[model samples]
Target: MSLLQDLFTRPRRNEQMGSSNENRSVLVVGLGRFGTAAARTLGELGEDVLAVDKDPMIIARWAGKVPVMEADLSDPLAVEQINASNFDAALVAIGDSVEASILTTGNLLDAGIPDVWAKSISHQHTRILQRIGASHVFRPETDGGKRVGHLLASRYLDYIEIEGPYSVVKVLTPPAVCGQTIAEADVHGRYGVSVIGVKNPGEEFQYGSNDIVMRHNGEIIILGSQKQIDKFIES
Candidate 1:
């Protein structure tokens, strides 16, 4: 049998479910790159996922892996048919067709799905999705570019942007702070950055403590605004 045919004959995850009302169940619409990635990660995280798409080939590929359904999510009736409201959250990952993306998002909202997250390709798309009641809108390409830009411009071993202007960064202990305890160096008072965690050369990460000494080659995780973090790193 062909791969698609073989997948079609296999038992689907949805069919094996004891109950669909389990906590953390998610409804994922659209089986594009973003959608598939989200579904797979959610599955690995132990969330029950029902992934829906209109393309039979996409459905075939995902069958028995996670819950897969073939349906036109742009159509409100189709969304209702699958009982999209049964899940705790829904993700609209349609990237190519703006019209379909908007329609699917609207359909989910109309179904009373409280948390509807959508992926937007442009500013206009984001605004429309928000106006139409999408709970959250993300631009993966734009966000990924900004994240990569931060990594490339600094000595940061890792960088993660938090809410507003704040960020969490991992970097080698600065020369100025080396060989001093957090309290002795007055890291917070002098640099305006909070050392939240630290990892020695061969040890696991540990919570930052005032008494913990900072070593020259050790790594520390700092939390502060971008400017403060940059200033601390430059010191």
Candidate 2:
């Protein structure tokens, strides 16, 4: 039997296998940096991941780490042989070639995979992928650049953008809020930002509460709209 056949027919590491509806069984195409990272992260999170790539060296390198197979996903036959429809989601992370990425994505969709996510390197690629029925198209380089720009331009130690204009930020507790309890500081009322968590030096993070005292040099996780967060950091 082929690798795809063996992977589909054999019992998974978890005895429950793909039978458990709570978890997802994902088919990851391509073995580039983004694909590898996604497969590893999904496996760590208890998701069933079957990663495929055309490179034999790449397959061997990730053998023990993630369930992987050697196959050129640009070919429709490869996708069909794997029973692509059985997967809850398919991520096409072929970054090098726009043609291969598009072909792989189309093949997955042709196989009836409902959620086919693809990685795109440019706006035109993104539009093409979307027009061809890709459920989602993500530009990792663009997103990462934005995140890095935000970090570099602000006092935030870490910044994460959520839906819309909201963001979550980790910042050093400023002098204005130091020596004051969360309730006394009135962070939410004064700055329109909510202190969701706090971490002191060399200590684990604790959920924010009314009684938690803020201290200089400590770190705080705040959530608010982008404008509110920028103002809070400036204050």
Candidate 3:
């Protein structure tokens, strides 16, 4: 019923969707809500999550919940202790301070983290994070923007633009598209988009296009480069 309940209600196996390997350790560089969620999710799925932050209060809050540490995330020494190159992945969720976000990400990349999933404030920051070796970066703020854009752009019941030039978008299946296979939709040929995944809000997700109608709040994600996404949006 509540947002927390909804998040926890998502299928257990689906929670940790990306990064197939769970045996490896994951480092969450910021202990903000986003970082906390990432850390807890990793920990829940049998992966080791190392959460670090500069705030003593935040660090103390998650003390036993997961392996948490208080450290100056911007300091290279703090990053050096962890074998970034060896860690399965890392997530940076520092809010507001663009420099701290950039610097901390640089430290992790420089430390040689195998993969980094940093959080950014905007499209510009996302690009910067990538240039610095962030394997991936997420923007909760921009995600909200995409949702709004989709709702406003079309008569589609739900909408979500895949971040960046990835023309792919994850949207609630517009009734206009219900009961139709992707090929029938001609999304690529017409909409200039490709399906990435489909998740019915309260049901399982179909990765890529396939047979099956996921439930309401079900998400249909289309993929394409930025230009392609723009074309779809404008259409």
TM-score of each: 0.83, 0.77, 0.65
lDDT of 1: 0.86
| Local accuracy of candidate 3 as per-residue lDDT tens digits, 1-235 | 7422333233332244775653666778888888888889988888766788899998889998888778876888876654455565678889868999999999988876667788888779989998888888788877777678766865444454544545345556665566667666666787667777777666676776645553444667766765665565444
Highest lDDT model number: 2
Can you tell me which runs of candidate 1 are displaced by over 4 Å?
Answer: 1-23
Question: Which tens-of-lDDT digit does each residue in 52-169 have in candidate 2?
Answer: 9999999999998899989997898887777776777889999999999999999989987778899999999999999999998889999899999999988989988887889999
Runs with alpha carbons beyond 4 Å of true place in candidate 2 = 1-23, 44-46, 60-65, 109-115, 130-136, 209-211
Instruction: Please provide, for model 1 over 1-235, each residue's C-alpha lDDT reduced to its tens digit, 9 standing for 90 to 100.
Output: 7433433343333544676654466788889888999999998988767888999999999898877889999998998777676666789999989999999999999987778999999999999999999999999999888888999998999988877989999999999989889999899998899999988787788899999888889999999998899889888
TM-score (C-alpha) between model 3 and the true structure: 0.65
Candidate 2 is scored at a TM of 0.77
User: What is residue 116's positional error in candidate 2, in angstroms?
Assistant: 3.7
lDDT order of candidates, top first: 2, 1, 3
Answer with 1 or 2, whichever has the higher TM-score: 1
Q: What lDDT would candidate 2 get against the real structure?
A: 0.87
* lDDT: the better of candidates 1 and 2: 2
